[model samples]
Target: MTERTFDSATSGPIVLGLSLPVGSVRVQVIESLITARVVLHTDDSTGPAADAVNRARSEQNGQVFGIEVPDMPNGVIVRGDRGTVVQSVGNMSFVGGTVRINGRVVSGGMGNMPTVSPIEATVCLPAGSSFGLAGTSADAEVFGYVDRMEFRSVSGDLDADGVRQLTANTTSGDINVGRVTEQITAHSVSGDIEVRLYDGSAATLNTTSGDIEMQATGAASGHVSAHSISGDVRLAGARHLSVSADSVSSRIRR
Candidate 1:
């Protein structure tokens, strides 16, 4: 278990390659720009990610090249690509077929104002990139696909045109998704949740203590379930939608 650091003129789009132990993997992304231009925090202490890191620094032509952390652990922050972050497969194979990244936090608009840039992470599995019960609860998981997704601190002004499939949980903030995969799950504790469905997308939303606003142009069989302790629920504009507002102060405007 070792560590290393680098200082480069990092900016723009970048990819993160991570390698962990034979267990689960967790990804926790944060933004607050004070540290440096870019930072790759690891969950595991596997000496130093030499080969992969050097390669990242080399091909970084200027516009903040991508990086691959050989052993990214839980709660480890991948500080770069102030844009979109993705979850994808690796060049090699995980020693274990099981991969989980639940109980994790994925966020943008960090480090600098409007931290949400154009960063995206692709998540795919190899053959049976299967898993049993990998927890995002500070465990080391690998890239095999995602079972659940959690979101935090998504500002209303952020433009999320490339967001596909997402599962989110927010606190004192706002969330908006333009596109969706097959299913999108979300819940908020103290803010409003807004989802704008693509032409033909499906989704599901749940919240407690906040409002739910959605827009769907296409025809998809989706539903929204909202419950609150002291907030209102709102929904509007969907070809097919079913919702349950459990709070007395919930509103829906779609």
Candidate 2:
């Protein structure tokens, strides 16, 4: 178990970035500090998972704080100034169950690949802070308010409360947001999306084989567009809004 803390009193609404593969993250919104506690669950204490946990690095460049775990090597370039990180995946490829970077084989085969251990991270940050998460099979839960949140994942579920803006893309993972004030754009291939919207909130939720459920509150005067290919779409408590809902081979209820 490793814990790292950063003081964000002077940074003022910092941006936190995380890249974790096969893990779970729980974020709590607090007052003024940012703390990240990580634990790697593995049987082998001297293996790659342990090494990756031991060698985890936290870098802060101005208002941007990034945590890097070597176990899942995603090409991320961090720039100094105000939290600018570029993820470059053009030179990476997976062929024949092997991982390659720049045409060089990193993992030879399924047997040669490093064992994937579940990493659990508990993060505490201030309110109004923004965050970006990149994960594979990693689930995340947030307990408080955030200014903006972005997630890109494969089979990773997300549950959050009170986000001003949110953009999430996942495959086979559900997204449930409690309160959306500004805007929300969520897409899932086979996962459900449920959100509660406030006044002047805009939402665009789409799913291929999962349900879309939305509840409007307090005037609900913004635009909402929901679509599902083979799943149900339900809208409740909505008044005075432009709504476009469609479903193919499924039910659309309002």
Model number with the top lDDT: 2
For 1-254, candidate 1 gives per-residue lDDT tens digits of 22244333443223323222111223222232222222333333332222323333323444323333333323232323232222221222222443333522233312221211111222222221111111111122222233233343322111233244555554444555555545666665665666655433445556566666666554555565555566665555553656454566544344
Prediction 1 global C-alpha lDDT = 0.38
**Per-residue lDDT of 101 in model 1:** 39
Top candidate (TM-score)? 2
Question: Which segments of candidate 2 are over 4 A away from where they belong?
Answer: 1-11, 32-44, 72-116
lDDT of 2 by residue, 186-246 (tens): 9999999999665546888999999999988866677899999999999987756789999
Computed on alpha carbons, the lDDT of every model, listed in order, comes to 0.38, 0.74
| Global local distance difference test of model 2 | 0.74
RMSD of 1: 15.5
RMSD of each: 15.5, 7.4
